[model samples]
Target: MKILNKTMISVLCSSLLAAGPVRFINPTNSYAAESDVENNTGFNVENSTSTANTHNFSLVNPDTNIDVDIKYTDNTVTVTTITNGAEEHTFTYNQSNGFALLDGKIMNLEINEPDFVIDSEETLSPQISLFATPSDKPVFVSPGNISFSESVDSVGKVVAVITGAVVLAKMIGVTLPKKLIETKVQDALTLIGLGSAIALNTMSGSFTYGLYRTKDKFYTGYPGSVNSYQYKFRYQDMAVNASLLGKTMNINFSEVGSWWFQSKPM
Candidate 1:
């Protein structure tokens, strides 16, 4: 009876092993696959001559091999890629303000203080505030002190140069002195003095002072790890007739809409 009982137990265990072990058989073996590591969105690096140039970037390939279409509107960018050769590939997508977590080297690249409007009317010493790009968000990077706050030295340098020029010209006879009478010298001196005094008082420039356009390009990273990316979108109207209303922009197509194409030069 004991031998028969042992035999039954052994046979039952053998059946479970041949059928497939529920406890010991590993499912992870079937699940293993190549790690798909690729970026979907392209980084718009400006003047990044190399891969490491963080600001100067190239488009990163999307994971899984697929042909793609890229689109943009306002500050948003979108990409659509064909997933399969035939079901053929039909996919739709939309994205906005997409960004990737860059490697540490990218964040470490130098960024200067952005051009800011000094609001003297509201505050006693309204500091310089950095602005955004193709945007108005706060600057990603900025200097603690702006080149705006203490521009007296700059003013003085300019003024002194002018003064020296005048004095030197007076000595060199390139300029007409008051003694020259009815000469261009007297008028020039008068204008010079007036301009100098005003410039001196407004050393830091007037509240309205600043460069018209900001620098939009930057750099990042070492070679091989990061990519440099840059992108531009442009559209032109092709119409035989058009009209403009107050505070409104309108485009009227005569027979057909304008054509749009996108690509970078080799």
Candidate 2:
């Protein structure tokens, strides 16, 4: 009976070893299995949603380039130019005074009356200004300056040369007509003296004051002066054409002591 009991105990132990451990499962739901499935599906959906959001963001914004910047205030207008995404030049203009500030320097604008009157009365003589150097300085030119007298003297000399040439030709028995000699001499003198006269005028004196004209207004200013070797002239008062106050002002240098604005070259 002991041997049989021991043998039965051994067989029970072997049967227990052959069978695996027991596991408990909830009848209501398989939470672990459902949780894994849901987690996997949510991860895939999140990835797809993230990709779509990135594509939409790229489409929403495309161009982000800036070239110029302009700002306006009650009294001033500022214009800034940009090159290669970098600031290049800035220009500011004053609406009230018609003055402009370029970079850091101030540009003055002087408005003259319609009658071009100087002092208190209107004058028949017109006064003008010229620029000698490429700089901002201006030199005032008037009839009273020594430079003007020199120009007049130059014309007289040219006349005298023609007269002398005519007399010399008669004395030499060339037998050329006085009018022909005069004409030929005058033409030669003009050709030879044209460059010299221009040089002299440019070097002797220039307009220290700049005159600018707009649609309905005339502007003028001293624009400061420079220490130049050229001589400068000034007058107590001067007059100019009030009608020149139009759009697109041009610098006129037809005469030494006079300047005016015209739509086209005169």
Candidate 3:
């Protein structure tokens, strides 16, 4: 698998530290909402008063002053972005067509249906493998051994480990050292059977968390053959991670340009 260079990782670390955390708060409520009503996807909802078939909320990032209004009805989800109290852009997604429309125009993007497999292999080993594409061709494909554990649910364990690392780093100090960030990334990668240096370089760019496998096998067919193994997994909502400056930034990936990340003080 192709890995990200050290220079790229360093640049990403610098950018995230400078930007700081982007808080997600409910406009209707004075306090922040901690739990999600629909899914355990970590997104904070603002308003929950809507028809039983429809769900409405706003994702406001105070740091950026960007308010994203999301409405879900049946299998259709519409996202509208408002900046500086003005509508900037809007996008709609329908579960029936699996296509996203931007401002009423259909875009050249396709949202693939998720294919989840649960078998004996998953019961034996659990790991996460990432595969992403900007177009029809995939630009990033990581090995299935990104995060592994002896536990039956390695995916959950990996998420907990990364989350704990972020919290621990925040407790350490405001300005985190480079070594500390490297150490945390290395620790998580080590659990998946990869060296520290390899893990850091491999996870430098846009990486998602939902593509995983419970089987220990990394690939199926021959490496250079035409029938070589390929990843066909996709999900509507994906958890994206970026480890920078001793903190792991968690972002939910819904579309190409409609993604947001939250950073914490460390």
Candidate 4:
């Protein structure tokens, strides 16, 4: 009887091993399942590079939405404003300096003073200022400082030779008065001075307090002035790509409308 019971136990164990683990389930539906993940909005990086990046942001104005586009690089920054998907204004700047290229002119940016100030019915625009280009030549001195040292030396030599001749004649009893020699020498010097003045006037045109205009071009009396009037606009951080060697990135500016006048050459 003991041998038969041990044989049955071995067979049962072998059958259980072959069947593996089993799952117990109810015939009726009663349970539910769920996942651990949460829902969220996605994010994206528009333009990414080792040296620069571009980002888009929006500003809500009184009744419209303003889209601002900014591009930042190693040493330069540029900012552009767009409305209704149409470009308005684009401003560019050099990070090393506060100088900006706006409205076809190189402008100096100053933000130390008050944003708005009024005096004597004059309206001062904010952020930037305009300056007139004194002249195409762009000089610190009008007509430039001139020197005629060689011409003066030549005039003096001629006068000396004439004086020596007159003195020699008198010493040899040739009847030439010293007064006459002096008067002639003085007259020659006067003519030289007059001639020099005429030549200078011709070379540089008329100069008032400063050279206002030349034959075909106009000039301003102020320093660092350009051909057109200076325009001021609300300052915005500009987007720039310093890695760009000599290539220019185009940015459309429509905020203040098209440039009123052409930009003068540097």
Q: Give all TM-scores, in the order shown.
A: 0.14, 0.18, 0.29, 0.21
* Each candidate: RMSD: 35.2, 48.3, 20.7, 45.3
To one decimal, what is the Cα RMSD in angstroms of model 4 from the true structure?
A: 45.3
Which numbered prediction scores highest in TM-score against the true structure? 3
Residues 133-212, candidate 4, lDDT per residue (tens digit)? 32232221121110111111222222222222222221111222223323332333333332111121111010011111
Ranking by TM-score: 3, 4, 2, 1
- Candidate 2's displacement at residue 150, Å, is 30
lDDT at residue 147 of model 4 (Cα atoms): 10
Q: Give a tens-digit lDDT track for model 1, residues 49-133.
A: 3121111112112322222232323322222222223211111111121121111111111111122232234321223333524
Ranking by lDDT: 3, 4, 2, 1
Q: Which numbered prediction scores highest in lDDT against the true structure?
A: 3
Per-residue lDDT of model 2, residues 63-115, tens digit only:
22112233445444454433234424444545455444444444222221111
Q: How large an RMSD does model 2 have?
A: 48.3
Q: What is the lDDT of candidate 2?
A: 0.24
Q: Which candidate do you rate higher for TM-score, 2 or 3?
A: 3
Looking at model 3, report the run of 10 residues with the lowest lDDT sum.
Answer: 143-152
TM-score of 1: 0.14
Candidate 3 on 70-167: residue-level lDDT in tens?
45554455655444455355555454554445556553331121123334455324343446222232222222111111111222223223432222
